[model samples]
Target: MGHPNDDTDKHLRGSLTKQNKKLSRLKCSVHNYDWGIVGNNSQVARLFALNSGSDIDPYKPYAELWIGTHESGPSFVDHGNGRLESLSLKTWISDNPNLVLGERLLRSGAVLSAEKALSIQAHPDKDLAMVLHNSQSSVYRDDNHKPEMALALTEFEALLGFISVKELMDVLCSVPEIVELIGSGNAKQFLLVNEQYRDKNAKAVLQSIFSQLVLSSRNKIGAMISNIKSRLLPEMQKRKLTDKEQLVLRLESQCPADAGVIAAFLLSYVKLNHGEALYLGGNEPHAYICGEYIECMANSDNVVRAGLTSKHRDIQTLLSMLKYTQGFPEILRGVSLNPYTTRYLPPLDEFEIDLSILPQATSVVFPSVPGPSLFLFIKGKGAITAGISENDNVEEGEVLFVPAHTEIRITAESTELHLYRAGVNSRFFTIP
Candidate 1:
């Protein structure tokens, strides 16, 4: 709860009288995490340096560049009053909801720049999110579901969803130590079952096997992990390794003697080349491995971590919430609406993304839209002119907040400009 005379209300009072406030350059927040790429090797660190106009340290693990109104790490909106006054994007949106978020996006969204592997986790759906938040406020934190899309800014790797039943069975057969943990009876039962991969009931069977593997007694898990290290590390040192094997080796290093190493083999491993994208909704079990990507999601952070984390793990809650369908996760190549723009439309109405590119000296106009939007400059330098006033120079790593029904024009000043526009879309909206 906020006070009545908050800065948000004061800023809105003067701005609402104006016909168009257009675009405002935003100062986003940065999160540093242990798993992030160390030092200037991180894209996030570079961006933070650029945004802060400070020298790079080359020693910090800059992790997440969060641009949004989310309470955890909200971006700040500059009032442009030549004073030191500023307001959180969340507060600004709250005060001028109709003017900023628009009718379609009464709910807003955010963009995240991830530099490393996030915890192996899933988010609860709307109903479950509310229940969890009310009952476990300290952990659940928020009542909104997080349905997200991650578009590769660089080569990205991730483990998404469950691997096919046949695939997991094969992995188990290859790693006898892991199979031994599940006991000979259960392993034999699972392997002998002849179930079609596409059958709906197949997921249930897969979950049972996976649950057994992940929830084995601590000593059993330790023995299996030790056995895997003994057998696999030598093999890796001697010769070539398969993609899945390589992933397993990597996870083992991060979380030694943890079941997540075994669990990684039961998940589909994916690599997204630059500019490619993938959409993940609530209850889809996934883990980012390493890479730089633009992640957009509904404004919530209720993560149910399963493993491969130092944070709290709610195994039962996480397992119960998963949409256990198994297969390779689909890679979404955004639909090209034009030569200049590609639209990444995820199923959720909370957000849609567009990657817009501009050739040197060329200009493009982003037409006024029904919802608020955030524009992030990923490559090249450009000048942005909003409506009839407020021009700003934007370079790589900077973000601009675009208000509802306000058009903006971008002109490239460098070889080429690449930027991403993310926001709630009217066409994608559906009453829930």
Candidate 2:
């Protein structure tokens, strides 16, 4: 067994959180491979533990961690309950106070992903979450405007928010080649609503126009992509910028610099390493994931994507939930280390954390462990024997998942390790 941890020192935190002293390791629920990982920086987080279940074969550097609940294959872990059980996140956090931090975390989970790029769709506010839930049982998970954050494992790339009308008009005008096909009917509609299009709304309208033109919206936007392949790719060959072009250039071959790229002009691009983090919360929306990242949020699984997904759009659903007036959507967090490790904070309660090196066996116990947690062992192979539990030892790439109110001890016996955790929350308690 590794050194025992003061549960209170490691887990129980708040304003009164007595500044964490002992290096801590909290378990989490990292779901089935989801959004595409940004293969950039990770040696900064230093959390690359040895886990048997990974995609890139022998494991390179630990990238991003996916910890939301969009269903799609929520990661399953070994529950401490005698048998290894798989539980959907939604059912586990019922009435769990920490999980319901003012109806915020759920809002974040319903959106982000790691595998297939999620479609561009907006989520309803509190009232709408209930209304949609009543009207269409499947789409609505809860009624909280979800805002999120993303810290670049290395230079991060994303298509966030909307572009102003003036900027979009310039992009549309640049590619006069397709003006003939833009059709007068919807074209006329755009002119009619032109005044209302501000930032993201304007971008969404442009995407809608482009989506209509795509030889196939439901299919691979392939034909349309092929049509513009020759002309738009010139910029990439001239690629000289150092920071981040939103990494959109990399996807140019796949998406082409069509009306969509311009209409969906990336509002901002950020590159972070070690301790930086991105916050996505409220109704501000964005899509596209590329890199190794650790994502965490509340406990619900529902996403209403419009562009990058093969699911439902619910036009009325998105139109009703958009933050039409929102310009800048989220707050970007910088990196700061806690002695040996670094913690990246997202908008909600959960965080995307990385520990540099595991010293023999450092231990930590949530002063108050969140009721429901599913820990995904992305990397690192170790013998995990929890607090006197009879279970033998868990190896690398194994999920050490625990249910609500499960307080236990953990130790990582490896040179270095990587783990992803989501939905770590607990009720309010006065330090006794």
Looking at candidate 2, the ten consecutive residues that score lowest on lDDT are: 15-24
- After superposition, candidate 2 runs with Cα above 4 Å error: 1-116, 138-156, 163-230, 234-262, 266-275, 324-337, 344-366, 370-372, 381-395, 402-412, 423-432
lDDT of 2 by residue, 85-204 (tens): 333333333323444333333323211224334445554545666677777776675544444445443444455665456645544554443344565554445555636554435656
How many clashing pairs per prediction, in order?
0, 63
RMSD of each: 3.3, 9.9
Provide the overall lDDT of each model, using Cα atoms, as 2-decimal numbers. Answer: 0.76, 0.42
lDDT of 1 by residue, 135-164 (tens): 999998889898888898888998899987
TM-score per prediction, in order, is 0.90, 0.57
